[model samples]
Target: MTLAIPDLPAVLETDRLIIRSPQPGDGPDLFDAVVDALADLRQFPASLPWAMEMPSVDESESFCVAGSESFQARKDFPFLFIDKTSRIVVGAGGLHRPRWTVPAFELGFWGRSSFVGRGLFSEAADALVNFAFASFDAKRVEAICDDLNVRSIRVCERIGMQLEGVLRQERRAPDGSLRNTRIYSKCE
Candidate 1:
């Protein structure tokens, strides 16, 4: 089952990064990151539907505000992966589709193209998974990605998430192609 609490910590830190929830006035920076990563992100249309449009600053801010409210209400927790030293949003990810009865959540993440292959997503995942168990009654945490996304699959493996199996032709890509989904999970 999924669980959340208003008093839960907003920021989670690892050795090299700080993962924090959405805050007000984050639109400009958030918008820039999306704009910078648009090209690469476009390749996976199924990820963030809002991101596919390359939203304006106002739109991005609106998104952040909604996210903040969910976090505050203990609905969902979508966090920003911030580089400790550079203070940039290297990537973002979070636990979603919470099943409170089972205390389970699905993990999703993406990173700036420039920071690709740096293991940032893995670091973020490690922290988020720990946060889930420590902050709530998380019995199982999952990370599912397009089967063809080798990078994301690697992130799952790097974080020690075991591959359950691939769901063949499970999703449709932005290019209108049927894609398989790889389901990975980490259980407590």
Candidate 2:
């Protein structure tokens, strides 16, 4: 069964991070993080189309506001990952594309370039996966990424998600070339 939005925890804590839903004032920090990681994000245009263009601070704020609304409506669960000690937004990720009927969710994540190689994204992602299973009673949690994204693949494997398969020519890359997609999942 699907849990009501009110029943969902808006903030989830880890030993070193605070994973929470986006709020109105989060735009500045979110903008900085996105800009810092823009080049890296642009590498997978098909997977991260939103990163193709630089968004204004207002646009980022709009995203936060809309994200909050989506969270409240139970349509999506976008989150910001903040460092516990520094209180800085280190990354962003969440369970998206929910299929409440089967109680499944698609996990997605990305870290600021400065925070890369720190394992913070992995920590946040693990917490999200656990939250999906525990809080949402999700029967299946999956992550799909560009086949060439080694870091993302490692994150999925590190969190014990098994590689289901790769979909050849699943989509087109930014350069108009065929791209493969790797699907990973942890199922009940």
Candidate 3:
């Protein structure tokens, strides 16, 4: 059975960040961020294909609209994480691709190249995980990452999501090679 949307605040604030839904005019800000982080993002070939080339402003706005619509529909929970003080959109992360039948959401994230060393994504993940459980009564929150992505694995671990197992040769990599996926989950 699909779970109904739960009541929650539109914006969530952590000590150093503010997490919120994507807005209509976020295209330019998003365009700048991806442009700034393109090199770093390209490292994960399968993460975002659009990052291969810079998107036009219209493309970015369309992405924002889609995210906003899905969020409003309670189909996916998306968030943009900004530095509370600097107000820079340092990173984006979300509880996405949810299976409300199982009440599980997959976590994914990315940070601007300049913010990688910092723990902003980790902080935001923590907040989102908390909200997912407290607000949505999720039975499981999981993160699936390429087995080779040590950085992503670390983020999942940092948030206390236990390694469930590895799915061998389950996906095709960005370079056309078969890739393994590491599954991590926090269960209620």
Candidate 4:
């Protein structure tokens, strides 16, 4: 079952980017970002499920619909990352909840191929972490990245998340190989 989070302001403008709730109209743009970023994203096992299936516009629409509902239910909030200058959806970011652990949440994010190495992910992450702590009064915010995804690991570290530990072979990549997951966290 999918969970929902309360909807907030439609757009969150950073100095260089706008983070906002995605609309059905954003389906095609988001789909393109996902496809374009596939190779870079495949490095992270968390996104392995979508690596093979290049989603259609309908599938992307379903994603936005689910995201909208999830926001309304106070479950999770998935926002499209838009470049302020271009006003284009360049990536995605959000929070995830494990029902067993209410109130505390996990952070998830990914950027398009062109957005990498530009530090937007870290900026967006810091914003989301701040939101989780302030808006939700969350006791803890966490993130996990594949060991091989050095860029993501660096993003997490850049945002002040401490390396808690590494879970050896906890995840299997799309390539059918076991991989280590680096766990990181920031506390309230």
Candidate 5:
């Protein structure tokens, strides 16, 4: 069964980061982070279609507003990862594609270019996994990424997610070539 929105915490904290639902004024920070990481994000265009074009400030604002609405509606949970020390948005990610019947969630994340080498993304992902299990009683949490995304694979592995399988030729890459997808999961 789906849990009430009020039962979920608006903010999830890790040792060095704060993962929180998008708020109205978060657009500028989000935009900065996205732009800083645009090249890396666009490398997997099919999986990140939104990164194909540069986003305007207004578009970013709208995205944040929609994220807030979606969170309230229990449609999706999009979050921004903020560094506790610098108070900068280091990345954005969330548990999406909810399967309430099975109590499952798909975790996704991307870090700002400047923050790519840090362990913050992995920390945030681990926290999200715990939140899904503890708050939603989720039976499973999964992460899917392009097979060539080594960084993402490392993040999944670092968080103790097991590689379930690789879906061969699952979709097309930006260059019109077949792309494989790696599926990783952590079960409660």
Candidate 6:
């Protein structure tokens, strides 16, 4: 279920980071992270479609507005991950509950290339999973990744999500090659 950013306390906090709503000022940071990690991101299904299709800064600004409004309207909860120690906006992630999925939400995340090996996605995902099961009253949370994305698979595993199944040749990448996808799920 899409959530309006609740007035509840911060979504998640670890010894080194805080995950919170993406603010207006984060557009540049978001852009930079995405651009910097384009090559790495292109290898994953979740980001391949957008890795090379960057819009103008003005367009990205508009997107941030829509994202914020959607978040506040209880339609989705997208967050920017911040390195508390350095005050850096290093990545973004989110939970999306489509109306058709009533009690379930899917998790999506990505990080700065430099931050990938530091366990940021794992910590952030664990935090989101907890928030979904606890505060959102979610009964299930799912994460799907390209079959070849080992890093993402590890993150899902670290968060205790069980490998559910595989979708055979579910997607055709930009290169027109078919790709299988792995699905992981956690049920309350």
**lDDT (Cα atoms) of all candidates against the true structure:** 0.83, 0.93, 0.83, 0.80, 0.92, 0.79
Candidate 2 wrongly placed segments (more than 4 Å): 1-6
TM-score of 3: 0.92
lDDT score, candidate 1: 0.83
lDDT of 4 by residue, 1-188 (tens): 44344446666777788887777677888888888788877666553567666789888988988887787666677888888888777889897873325567788888898878899989888888888776776778899778888887898999999999999988877678888888899987
lDDT of 5 by residue, 67-150 (tens): 999998888988899999999999999999999888899999999989988899999999999998998889999999999998
lDDT agreement of model 2 with the native: 0.93
Where is model 6 more than 4 Å wrong at Cα?
Answer: 1-7, 45-47, 99-102
* TM-scores of all candidate predictions against the true structure: 0.93, 0.96, 0.92, 0.90, 0.96, 0.89
Q: Model 5, residue 176: what's the lDDT?
A: 94
Span of ten consecutive residues with least summed lDDT in model 1: 1-10
Which is better, 4 or 5, measured by TM-score?
Answer: 5
lDDT of 1 by residue, 1-188 (tens): 33345368858988889889878888777777778777877776765555678689999788789889988877888898889999988878889988888789999888888888787888899889888887876999999887777888898998889999999988877788888888999999
Q: Give the TM-score of candidate 4.
A: 0.90
Error of 4 at 177 (Å): 1.6
| Residue pairs clashing, model 5 | none
Give me the displacement of residue 48 in model 5, in angstroms: 1.5
**80-184 per-residue lDDT for model 2 (tens digits):** 999999998988998899998888999999989999998898899999999999988899999999999999999999999999999999989779988899999
Candidates 1 and 5: which is better by lDDT?
5
Q: Report how far residue 113 has shifted in candidate 2, in Å.
A: 0.7
